[model samples]
Target: MSASAKKQSIYEPDQEGLYFPRPPVFSTVAEERQHRRERLAAVCRIFARYKFEYGFAGHVTVRDPEHPGLFWTNPFGMSMSRVKASDMILVDHVGKVVEGTWAVNQAGFVLHSAIHEENPDIIASCHAHTVNGMAWAALGRPLDPITQTACGFFGHQAVITEEAGAVVVERGAGFAVAKAFGDSKVAIHQNHGLFSVGRHSIDEAAWWFIALERACEIQLKAEATGSPLKLVAPEKAAHSAKHLATPFMGWLHFQPIYDWIIRTDPDLVD
Candidate 1:
């Protein structure tokens, strides 16, 4: 064997791309389901790595590929850092745990189920109690596009003021939050935290939530300095948002984070 060949890893991209190559194609729904399970577990670890965990306050869900109406989510009360593919619970629309031993979190059930039920286009949802998101939600206003990161949500984000500072444990409250997501991918639940949805994959949903939180923190920090915030022009912010806010864009951005988690927390896939 050539020296170069020995130096290369066993894996290789099927095709080349400027960003990442096209992900592998799955011939059966079974393969895709496992892929999503791994992705879900990876998302948990990624958020944990970034200190997004707040005593199991965060939850993410992806529609089951085999059963479109059902979804897979991290088990209730599980620490975010310790969530594994084996710990994922498969729940139906009615909040019943059809698979896994762990009970589902009522908050995850109420909030995620409503969004997944209302939006057929949305296949995944992410919600978390990030400090910055909660801080911004306290303001009870939409995010101003003061930076490129914030612009990623210029026209695709909204604020939910109904259940301010309250946990949404009822189906009605959950439905109300879902309604606030009208035509938007991100929602800052007033005095709560953040909620983001992805059309195709939870990768996008998770990445968008992380991005939105960081943007909120940046905005808050920038404002606290007592300096005038230089807001982006509406047209420019819209254009930038259009370019950065797509589901695929978020999924692509998550690839490295996914890989990082896989390396650092290999047990997440157990």
Candidate 2:
């Protein structure tokens, strides 16, 4: 079908925009849409606050509960700090664009779609190229859980030694990433970057990244000191993870950082 015909069939075209007149309008329902908008905005703001975003690169995806095969993801070419709910695109499980105008990042779909497809428990996925996270990714050694903060990923870190280009472009890349993850929550894509999966929001991944980064930084500093590195016991690490981790704590830690993003660049909300 022609572009104009397709638009005419599904929506009323106007200067204001294509309108879905039959879509339900609700007072409280609008509040939910606004909440989704703010949550997406919060993700962008947090990325900006930590400088985790690299221009239009990297993205976060959240699954639509009603549509198991569909998800909401940041639009391609949009800065993480500038993302809005209206800017998110709904994509099918195979990475096909189902709604919204912007394109989806192929790399993001390569990694996120299979994870979402295979792991029903994972409601969200966040991928990034932060300085420390990327640095750790390049290291031959994985991030050692030396501190309490790092214990969140105590037993969940996996290293992917496969060529980065291979995973990004190949059809089996998603399966490769999923294999590397195994039963883990975090995967260290050696020489690439960090990826974290969780129940919802980018908040969990953000916390994991920050904690892992700090752990790596401390390990480096301790190495330079020429002192024997103190390590947490395996049992203790497990205990801490079970007792300390919650979606609430994840949001708490990143909200202040996001506040910084909001204050410094309020235009990000636009």
Per-candidate Cα lDDT values, in order, are: 0.86, 0.68
Residue pairs with colliding backbones in model 2 are none
Report the lDDT tens digits of candidate 2 across residue range 152-216: 67777777776553447554777667666776667778877877776655566566566666666
Q: Candidate 2 has what TM-score?
A: 0.77
The ten-residue window of minimal lDDT in model 2 covers 2-11
The TM-score leader among the candidates is 1
- C-alpha lDDT of candidate 2 relative to the true structure: 0.68
What does candidate 1's lDDT look like per residue over 69-113, in tens digits?
999999989888888998899999879999999989886689899
Location of the lowest summed lDDT over 10 successive residues in candidate 1: 5-14
